[model samples]
Target: MTGQTPSHSERVDWLRLARTRQVGPVTFNKLIQRFGNAADALDALPDLARKGGRSNALRIVSREQAEQEIEATHDAGARLQIASEPDYPGLLATLDPPPPVITIRGPLVPDDHACCAIVGSRNASAIGLRFARDMAASLGRAEIVIVSGLARGIDGAAHAGALETGTIAVLAGGIDHIYPPEHADLYGDIGESGLLVTESAIGTSPTARDFPRRNRLISGLALGTVVIEAALRSGSLITARFAAEQGREVMAAPGSPLDPRAKGSNRLIRDGAALVEDANDVLDILHQAKRPATAEPPAEPYDPADAETGDGTDHDRLQSLLSPSPVPIDELVRQSGLPPGLVHAILLELELAGRANVLPGGNVQQAWPEDQD
Candidate 1:
């Protein structure tokens, strides 16, 4: 909620807290809102996790490790951009729970230049790839910045089309690591002429789990998302979903019913996504798309003096209510008859202990160690 420039020590603390195990973006934000700063939150994690039922010591990234990560990021020619900073991307800031720390490898594109995400299957058909590239090029010429994950097929084509004008490749790995290694040249070119972004830390490689998190960022950075060709379970659909959840436009290029890759996009159109035939179609959507206003600073997490740590009976009551299914926090508040603040505090503890998954959009699900992949 504050815009004061963080000190070096503050930066390290932020990174440390952000890198702590089980502390995802939503949890991190909650901790910050409650504690007002990362240093205090880092100090509080042990007790929090213990209350949440962790049998082992909660793994918190050490100051030394965090420092090494900063060093590694610098060595890779990238810099950390914290969410509280004035320079953080405006569109990205509007996300309900934006990444606390993201590593950027290029100059910040101005907020005035609208961005659109183009995503689709990694195994795009030839015709689909051509459409994606041409659409991106035309959008670029019209002053829209293209955003995509630098994968094979449609993603690569989109980036290549917009590379000269402006493009952003959102990586699922560290700024230092490249996935689909064949795109080394494309990665380098984008870093030089456009921008590269990621939530991953230095030296961290992309895993299957990372892409969905990365997809959210792709949609978060843009005014809208356009799906070129995607299957029912495509990652591109994930990006479009995120765009819709963030209140941004979701557009899809219609494809043949016979092509499996088109199913997702076609389904999107059927479900009310804007139909995109060409760049002009996308442009028309953008013309009507409302850019989010500059975000107001978030509310304080809670007042420490007024907060109450619930007793054992209250904890047991909440535990009995939470099954493996995801439930809205408000439902927990109502069902348990606990104060909203106490419920969140308990949930934070459960999340830290790895006993629960605190997903985006305020959903919580049971997550025992055995349940994790």
Candidate 2:
């Protein structure tokens, strides 16, 4: 969400680079920063992967494959929005590394629009469901766009309440592949009235790893995230965590102490998340909020001299300091007594070699054999 819309051929190169194996959001942004464009980034991948000690060349998506994906998106009545495009959501552009490209169906909200996400247990209680629905409706009446994953209980009810106003459904699968088949009708309704979004290709199905990515976007798209009836370990809490990390407001509805479904939300309130009883509480918080600034690309151009193609000496020195336990990248720089750029370069190579895991919140851990699976 920083640059102008890419032309047709440029868009295909973006897709090809984005779909290349091992190129996550962070890597994609770094490649763009290093090379200045997707086509050049695609050309650099094999050499970069090899420098990291990969035995085989990196597997990059072919131009034909990328073109087919673009065509399929159009066939499904959706359009692709690159992060640099003006049409990408403004709030989402604030993320350190937003989705490089997203497939969107329906129209996006106006640039000045304020969105609040409502997320919670899929097995929520009756009272919890009612509160989510009513809260979403009240906020919608105030012209706030509601955002959520199209799940069973709270998400479904929230979407139903805000359908007439505006809403956005961020999917874990392809925009066309509706999960929880029971919500097919709701999915259709949103497609026509609200926006449907996903970072996956047209034929990709939801997997265990995809939901967290979807949750990140749920929080990234909004100004704040509200949780209701979440358990101690649930996706709703994950969404709220992302909200907080992204400098967005995090709020949770109070629930009974005895209910297992209420444990997470109650804990959030205990841990200093704003306790809310209704949409008014959310509005009060939003009234006092300052919108986040858009994230900008790296200022300096790529310097080959700075991105040193390390020899085994540097790689081995870094490897000796790493363990299976997750540690901050800053700590790695301090411990290894190496320049930050060299540390990052080596770490990226280690990641492409399947020897390291670059986690959210700027953490890294050595990847185990099972982790590769």
lDDT of each prediction vs. the true structure?
A: 0.86, 0.85
- For this target, which candidate reaches the highest TM-score against the unseen true structure? 2
Candidate 1 TM-score versus the reference: 0.93
- Candidate 1 regions exceeding 4 Å error are 108-112, 294-309, 316-325, 334-337, 368-373
| Per-model tally of clashing residue pairs | 1, 1
TM-score of 2: 0.93
Q: Which residue pairs of candidate 2 clash?
A: 1-83
Clashing pairs in 1: 33-301
- Candidate 2 error regions (>4 Å): 110-112, 296-303, 316-326, 366-373
**Per-prediction CA RMSD (Å):** 2.3, 2.2
Model 2: lowest-lDDT 10 consecutive positions: 298-307
